[model samples]
Target: MISCACPEFALDNNPDTRAAMERITAAEADLLAARAAFYPQLGVTVEYNRTNNPMYSFGNILNQGLFTNTIDFNDPGTTDAIQAKGVLQYRIYNGGRDAAAMDAAINREQASVFDNETVRLQLQANIVRAFCSIVQAEEVVTARQSALEAISASLAVAQARFEEGSLLKEEVLNLEVQQARAEERLIHARHCLSLAQRGFLRLLGLQGAAVQLDAQGSPAQEIPANPDINRRPELQAMAAQIRMLEAMVRQAEGGHAPTADLFGSYQVDRGAEFGDGSGNSWTTGIRLNYALFNGGRTGAEVERAKALLREAREKRQHLELACTLEMEQAVLALHQEEERLKVTAKMVTSARESARLSRLRFKEGLLLSSELIDTENRLTDAQLSHSLATASRTIAIADLRRAVGLPQFNHGK
Candidate 1:
């Protein structure tokens, strides 16, 4: 029965994952602001002023209906006036600038969503690679332990033969030396496993979490025959960028056109001397504004925006070619690792048989101690090679999946 358990991908506690999610939220906020810009604004204003000017002194008195009490208007004294107002303003037209800006913001937000997915997939791939490393290292440690045990048995046999005068002291010493070397290798292998575990834990944001990894190697699978770059997040992001640049071009050209807004306000005026005779007024109108010229600034902005659009298109083209090359390379690597794994599997089987035969021959006086040690070393190396080949194949598969923008792995915890 399989005793290993696969990790589940947990993005909740990861710092980089949280950061990517936050970026998407920020982009959403920008999109909302862009949409809100299309609506009208309402505001209230209140003011109190004391004016001593000749024109305002008389005007305030008339406005407040206090002229009857101020019969000596020739002595136009200071006037204290209080005003409260409510204002409404709305942009009726702006040459499609708001539309372009909103479109650009929408594209940016979509791109951010794609970027977040890309980060997630990339992190999952990393986790897969790290876990595979730990699995490979653990296998190596197991292989080394097995080798140590076999060598210790051989050393005991040699010691017994030496005591019975059937083996030389030098042969026994040679077996002891091999035993020591095997033990040394086992120690190194265990250390490698420790390091791999540490790295795996750190990647999961669990610095000291006790865990058992179950990175089972999957059966050999066929590489993707035709991978499409369009589905890739990077390409989608580029496409969004192109759209945003096009929107920017529209926004820049909009500057050459006039803008119109509807504005209205209602006000109440009261004077200190004529508080009971307050007056109210209302005003409303549509305002038109045009930027006649700005020293070629508008023209320059339009040109710049067009240039940026072209640049984005060119970059997308370049990236498409690069992705194609990367996918091809990943596929080729997968095939190579698959072949290497097959060859190493055969080697491991043959080496194990040879080691088993050599142990028997050494015990029956048909093989020298040195010969047995050589066979044992070859078996250990074969096991290690097979382990590495298995890991390489697994990693290659993960890379190919990532190259084709496939989010298939479960990782974490």
Candidate 2:
């Protein structure tokens, strides 16, 4: 495997991160729409009509400034009229419904931001876990390879002694059997390493790309003395959701009040064709709307909103508890991995010394072949254990940082 720097999330193009970013963009669009509702609306419309109806013909003729005593009131003839009107409308009051909508949008946008952050942090942890797994698997392969080599060397010596009639045939056969087992172990370790590498590539969104690792020794950071999940993005996101739900409740309540709006319009009317007649008019007024006969819809909306707010509040409590538990579990895992690493390191040292001494004794015909084989196997196991412990500790560090809403490897960045 080629050695390379750790994968960058921004470069990896993780689908989850991309999806989260899109959600944030959507939330921002909603916020913009909410803010736009606060401003006055201006629009233009054109209306054209041709009619012979007595009432409409008289009105159209009057608007066209062609009304006269000569006009027949009972059976006015056909008339054509076109009006180009420009209208402006502004909401003067809506019982704070618009304000509540704005607030809700603002909170939703905030929640989206925090949700994205939470997704990024969790993905980072997963990448670290995958990366660590590959490193540990590779180390195990190395340990297995070393074990196989040691067994081969011991078997060669046993065969040589048996050829000279100085060692029992059973002893040489034992060495041969152990050598085959060692080869099997090595093959299995390599298989596992390959699987781990492929998994890492998939996690990086680089399915067919080469596998590599920065192989920077485990993070040097220790268990945090003050484990705090207050800054965890998941919890913050939930808090924002709760606030958004509260605003929705307020918006539903505002539906009970009447709405007032200020409106103004200017119109230019072209009268009967080929008559060189026209009329211009301007009007300004206020409009009020009261939903006096809705069948309990407003009340139902209010109740539904209140129910959602209560659910959000409960979810917030549950989210906080879940985050706290995660933080505690991460801390304890870090401590446990730390102890395991230390223990494995000691075991490797002792086993290495024992294997070295056993090899010397076996060479001098003072140690049994079985004893020498056991020592070599212990050394290999100890090495593999140490490697796993190291990787686990590194992963634990990343997990703890994720729980605290910190960066994966580097502390601040």
Candidate 3:
């Protein structure tokens, strides 16, 4: 015996992912229903009737001492009839409607599988993007903390200089303002981090569980070569649609062909009379039906089916174009984001050096508190920009993968 746990209540597993699997199961069920069309049908029927008067009749009496025998009948309050029939009907021939229907069902099932895959891929991409956001926010918090420390040190120096009448009160006030701003940024960064974490947990369908994510930053992976966008689930789904429509067209064309069926049935009946008698009956026959004309209705249906097939094809073409454009845009965006990240990284280094130099000069009474505060703000901005750029690049890559039907980061491994 095999035991399976229900995934519906699994907290660690994503519900969207589970739903995608369920959709495939549902499609299988549909296919089963379609298969049932090829099986025989069995039915039972019962009927009852009541009559106030009953007819009596006497058959010819045999010559025996010149005597005639009469039969009398009593009216039953109600009469009951029951019949059970097992009918076996098979299509000996048709315009090809049955075959077309089966083909359409198969295409529909295939499309459903593709749709499920598409959903799964999309959800995986979302998870990657959300995780990236959380990491970026955490980095921002660290950068803000560093800026806060720098601002606090500058304020302390400004206070000492003011006490010695070497710095103006306004200079100390400016340093205090910078410290407040840094604290505000840190608070905002923390809030953003919390939100991102919660979103990630929700995507994994773990609402109440605490999550700890590994935050090791590594160089981005190289893009895969020669991605076949046509094989993407989205495009595959569209292709399936076109195939299904073609099947429909074939079915409609079959409407103009003759249909034939072979059927057989057996029945038994019982009668209550002077002498109870039972009888059995059997029937076997073939039926031929042909729709010679239907006032142009069949023609209209054929045309309509053809139109739908064409529409599906056109829609697929449009989607292919759109996908190509999106892929190109994503590639360009990733490149731009990567370049910006490099520039911001350099900026952060430069700002850090400038801040360090200004702090030392201020402590020696060679620079003002304002200069140190400005450098600290510049460093904070540069760090934040770098983090944002990195997040953007990560998200862009995920998007590109999704557009081309590639798997997101490995969740199973």
Top candidate on TM-score is: 2
* Candidate 3 residue spans exceeding 4 A from truth: 1-12, 46-80, 217-222, 293-296, 410-413
Q: Taking the tens digit of each residue's C-alpha lDDT, what string does model 1 give over 245-342?
A: 89999999999999999999998889885456577889999999998778999999999999999999999999999988888888889889889999
- Name the TM-score of candidate 1: 0.91
Best by lDDT: 2
Which is better, 1 or 3, measured by lDDT? 1
How much does candidate 2 score in TM-score?
0.93
Clash number for candidate 1 = 2
Please give the distance, in angstroms, between residue 255's alpha carbon in candidate 1 and its true position after superposition: 0.7
Can you write out model 3's per-residue Cα lDDT over 13-63, one digit (the tens) per residue? 787767777877887786677676676655555533223344311111111
